[model samples]
Target chain A: MSTDSAAGLLHDLAEYRARARRDRHGYWLPLLVFGVLILAAPLVYLPPSEWPPPRVQVSADGLFPGQIKVFGLTIEPLYMFGPGNGREIGNPMGVSWYWFGVVVLGLAGTVGWYRWRARRVGVETPTRLVVLAGSVGLLFLLGVVPLILGQALVLLFPGSYFYSNTAFWISVEVFVLAAAGTTVALWVRGGGPRPAWRVALASVGVVVALMSITIVFEAAFGHGHAPLLLLSVALLAVAAIERSAFCAVIAALFTAAALLANLYNMENVFYRFGFHVDYLNPRGEVFANLLLPAAVLIVGGGIAAWSARKASRRE
Target chain B: MSDHPTAGLDDVVHQKHRLAILTIAAEAKRVEFGYLQQNLDLTKGNLSRHITVLAEAGLLDVEKGYDGKRPKTWVRVTSAGRRALAEEIATLRALVARHENLS
Candidate 1:
C-alpha cells in the first residue's frame, strides 16, 4: 500500500483506540464510585464508639416498642426516637450495609452497562446524561420525596400521622395498582402511541384481578408472603407480550412497595437478603432511604430513554 | 441511460457531517450545540457554520441561552426538515431496489 493509505489506516486505528479509551473511562468511573460506596458501607454500620449513638426515643405507648422479642431474638428499634417519646430506630447493621451495597452497586452497574452499550453503538454522552437525569428526576418526584415526606410526617405527628389513615392507605393501594396497571399497559403497547381507552381499562382490570389473586393467595398462605414473587411473575407475562421496560417498571414498582412495607413495619420480615437491606446508622439510613430509589429511578429512566432514542434512530 | 430523476438523493442526505448532525438531532429531538461539537468531534466554528447552513435551509431551529455564566445553544429539527429527510431516505431506498432488480 502507498504511504498515504498506510498513514490513513494508522490514523483510523488511533481514532478507534481513543474512542475505546473514552468509553472505558466512562464505564469504570461510575463503577469505581459505586464500589467505593459499597466498601465504605461497613464503616457506616460499625461506626467508631466515639461517634455519637443515633438518638432514638420511643413513646411509652408506641405500637412497636424499641425492643421486640421475636422468636427469642431481641431486635432493637431501627429508627431514632424523638423528644415526644416517639420510637426511633436505625437499620440493623447487617441489613443496612447489605442493602447500601446492593443499591449503590446495582445503580453503578446499570449506568455503566447503559453507557457502554450506547458507546458501542456510538451514541453521545450528553443524550445519555439527559435521559439519566430525567429518569432520576422522575424517580425523585414520584418515589423518594414522598417516602421522605411520609417518614418525616410520621415522625412529627407520631400517633396522629396520616400514614395510618384509611384514606391514605387506600390511596397508596390505588396508586400502586395504577402504577402496576400503567406499566403493564405500556408494555403491551410496546413503545407505540398510548393505547386506546378500552385497552387501558382492560389492562387496569387485569392488574386489579392479579392484585386480588395475590391478596387471596397471601391470605391463604400467610400474611407475610412475598408479593414481589407474584408481581415478578406478572411482569414476566407482560414482558412476553410487550417490551422489557414494562417488566423493569413493574419490578421497580414492586421493589418500591416492598421498601415501603419494610419502612412501615407492615412486612413481618425486617429485611430480605437481596434488595431490602438497609444501612443501620441514622445518617446512613437517610442516605440509603433517599439515594437508593433515586439512583434506581435515574438509571432505569436513562436506559429507557436511551433505548427509545436508539430505536428512533434505527427507524 | 437513466430515466429516473433525483439521483442526488444520497448526496443530499448523506453529505459529510451533515447527516451526523441530522441523525443526532432526529434521535435526541433537541441537542445542545456544545454537545454536538464534542460528540461529532468538530471545531466550534465548523459546527456553527454547518448549523447555520441547516438553519438557513429551514432544516433546523437553533436557540441560544445562558446557564448561569455559560452560554448554551440548542438545536431541533423542523417539520419540513423531517419531510425532506424522509423523502431523501425513500429515494435512496428506491434507487437501491431498482439496482437490485437490474442485477
Candidate 2:
C-alpha cells in the first residue's frame, strides 16, 4: 500500500492503545458503587425512633447469661436472659455505631477528595488469577481455619477453653497466618518482574486491603456477611473480565444472592432470635430494608455493565 | 492489480482519521461520534469531514439521536467497511515488509 495507508493504520493502532490506557467508565463506576455500598450502612445509618424494626419477641429463660461461654471465649451476651424475661440482644457492632459513622465518613470523604484532586487516569488490571487465588485462600484462612481450630480447642480442653487467653492468642495467630499466606501466594504469582522491596510492599498492600475488607465487613455486619460479600467480589471480578451484557447477567445473579442473604439475616435475627421492634410503617420498612437495596445493586450493576460494553466492546 | 502492497488499498479507509474511526467503531457495537472525536483528538470540522467521506463510501453507518436534549451521533462500521479495513491493514503490513527487505 501507499505510505498514507500505512501511516493511517499506525495512527489508528496508536489511538486504540491510548484509549486502552485511559480509565473507562464501565469498570470505575461499579468499583465506586461497590465501595459506597460497603461503607454506606456503617457510615450513614441513622437511628430510627423505633429501632430494630417490627418484630415479635418470645421469652426464653436463662438462654443467655453474663459472659456466656462460647469456644473458650467468654463473650458478653448483648441480650438479657433471666428468670422471667429475655430481652433482644443488641448487635455486637452496636459499640461501633457510636464512632464508626464519623470515622468512615471522614475516611471516605478524605479519600474522595484526594482522588478527585489527583484526577488520575488509566485502568490497571490486577493479576486476576493471582488475586482470585489469594482472595479464596484468604477466605479459607479467616473463616474455615478459625472454626476448625476453635472446634479442636473446645474438644481438647472442654472446661478450660471457655474465656481463656489461649483462645484470643490462637485467633490472632490464625489471622496473621492467613494474611501472610494470602500475600505470599499473590507475590509468588505476580511479583517476579518487580523488585523484592516492591514485591514486599505490594504484598503488604494486598494483605492490608484484604484484612481491611474483612474487618470492615465483620465489624459492620459480623456473622453471615461472608457469603454475600464473597459473591459481590466474585461477580465484580467476573464483570471486569467479561464486560457488557454478560456483566448485566452477573449483576442479576449478584442481586439474587444478595436477596437471599437479606432474607436469611432477617430470618435469623428477627424470627429465630425473637428480636422484633415495631416500625412506624411496617410494610414500607420491610420493602425499604430488603427490596430497595437489592434493586439498587441489580440496577447499578446493569448500568455499569452496559457502560462497560459501550466503552470497551472487546472481550 | 499489481502485486504491490498499495495496489488494492481502499481510499475511504486509507486516511488517518477515518482509519482510526473505523478501528474504534469496529470494536464497539455502535461507537458514539463523540467518543471517536475525543479519542482521535480531532476537531468537529475535521472529524465531520472524514466521517462524511466514510459515510459516502458506504463504509460507516451514521445514526443521529438525542441524548436527553443534546443531539448525539453514533457510527458503526459496516461489514464492507470491516472487510476493507482488514484488507488495508494486511496490505500496509506487506508494503512495510517489502520496503524493509529492499532496504
Candidate 3:
C-alpha cells in the first residue's frame, strides 16, 4: 500500500474504536430514568403541613453521642437516639421505603435493559458484574462488616457491647446463594449446556431469587434508607462495562450522595460552597439530599447523549 | 535503528484491517464478532481469515460463546498485540511525518 493508504488506515483505526464504544454504550436512558427516580425519592420527606416550624427541640439521643460542627453549622444527622428527643434532620419512614423500591428496581431494571439491548444490538455485556457487586455489598454491609465488628465488640469488650451471634450463620448461607447466582450468570455467558445457555442459567436464577429475599429486608426499612449503596455499586459496574468515564462520574456522585444522605444533612455540604438550600423550604435539607445527585445524573446523561449524537453525525 | 520509517512497521500489524481490529479491541475489554464484522465492512469469511491469522500469530484471543440462543464470538487483543499496535502506530506516525516534510 502507498504511504497515503497507510496514513488513512491509521485514521480508520480510531474511527473503529469510537464506533464500537458508541454503539455498545447506550447508557443515557438508564441515567435519565434513574435521575428522574432520584429526583422523586426525597419528595416523600415533605412535611404533612407545607411549612413545619424550624427544628429547635434538642434531644440527647443522636445516632452518635456528639454533633459534627462544619462551617460553623451544627450539622444535623438524619437520625438521633437520645433520652430527650434530639431533632432529626428529616425522619420519615416513607423516604426509606421509597429508596428501597428505587434501588432494587433500578438495579433490576438495568439488568433488564441490557438484556433487551442484547436482543437488538446483538452484543452481550455481562450484567452479572452489577448484580454481583450490589449483592456482595449488601451482604457485606448488613452482615459481614457489622457481624465482624459485633463479634469483636462482644469478644474484646464483653458485656459493654452486645453483638448478634446468631446472624453470622444466616450471612454465610446468603453468600453461598450469591456465589451460585454468579456461577449461573457465568455459565450463561460461557455458552455452557446444550439447550439455551440458561436452562443452566435458570437453575442459577433460583439462587438469585433467594438472595433477593435475604438480608435485604433490613435495607428495605433501614432507619432512613439503605444509603443508595445498591445504585452506587450498580453504576460503578456499568462504568467498567462501558469503559465510560461519564458513567464513573455518575457512580462517584451516587456514592457521595449515599454517604451524605446517611451521616450529614446534604444541605450542609452545599452550605460550605455558599449555596444554602434553606430558602427553598422548611424541608430544604431533604431536597438537598436528593437534588445534587439527581442533577448530576440528568446532566451527565444529556452530555453522554449529546456525545453519542455527535459521534454518529461524524461517522 | 534504520534510517527509514518503513523499517519500523510491524509486518503482522501493518495491514489496514488488522490494525483496525487491534485498535477496536484495545478500546474495550472485548468486542463482539458481529461488531468487528460490521465496522470492518468485511464478509464473515473474510473477517474470519484475518482473525485466524491474528489469533495464530498470538495477537488476539477469540472466544466462541452465545448471547441467549444466538451464537456469539468475542475478540480481545493480547498484551503482545497491544505492544505491537503501539509500535506499529508509532512507526506509521513517523512515516506520515516524513511524508509531510518531503511534501
Error of 1 at A159 (Å): 20
Which residue pairs come into collision in candidate 2?
A1-B5, A1-B6, A53-A277, A54-A277, A55-A276, A55-A277, A72-A161, A72-A162, A72-A163
Candidate 1, residue B27: the lDDT equals 50
Worst 10 residues of 1 chain A by lDDT: A78-87
| B1-102 per-residue lDDT for model 2 (tens digits) | 557777767767877678778776665446666666677789999999999999899999888877568787867779998998888777777777777678
Candidate 2, overall lDDT?
0.51
lDDT for B58 (candidate 2): 91
Estimate TM-scores for all models: 0.39, 0.37, 0.59
Q: What is model 2's native contact fraction?
A: 0.21
Any runs in candidate 3 off by more than 4 Å, and if so which?
A1-6, A43-105, A122-136, A154-226, A233-237, A248-260, A266-285, A306-315, B1-8, B63-74, B78-80, B94-103
Write one digit per residue (lDDT tens) for candidate 3, span B1-103. Answer: 5579888777778788888888888776577788778888999999999999899999999999876688888888899999999999888888888889889
Instruction: Kindly list the per-residue Cα lDDT of model 1 for residues B1-103, writing each as its tens digit.
Output: 9656345454445454665676566554356776667767899999998888888888899878765687768788788777766665455455555655776
Reference-based lDDT, residue A289, model 1? 35
DockQ of each: 0.16, 0.12, 0.27
> Considering TM-score, which of the candidate structures 1 and 3 is the better prediction for this target?
3
lDDT of 1 by residue, A1-315 (tens): 223433343344345334432332232233233334433443344433325445456656442444444444333332111111221233343433344334434544545564455434443233243235434533432233333333433443356433244535554476567667766765665566765884768676655544433333222222111222222233233233222444346445645753553243421243453345333333444334335433543454455456555754774
Candidate 1 local accuracy as lDDT? 0.46
Location of the lowest summed lDDT over 10 successive residues in candidate 2 chain A = A78-87
Q: Write the per-residue lDDT of candidate 3 for residues A1-315, one digit (tens) a residue.
A: 467976887788877776667777878877888889878765555554663535444455332223334444343232211111222434343444455567667778888887777556645566678889877765654454334332333443356222233443454465577667656565545444546544566656654434433333332223343446566777888888887887887778877866666555667778998887755443466567667777878898888889878977896
In model 2, where do residues sit more than 4 Å from their true spots? A1-12, A20-26, A39-315, B27-29, B34-46, B56-58
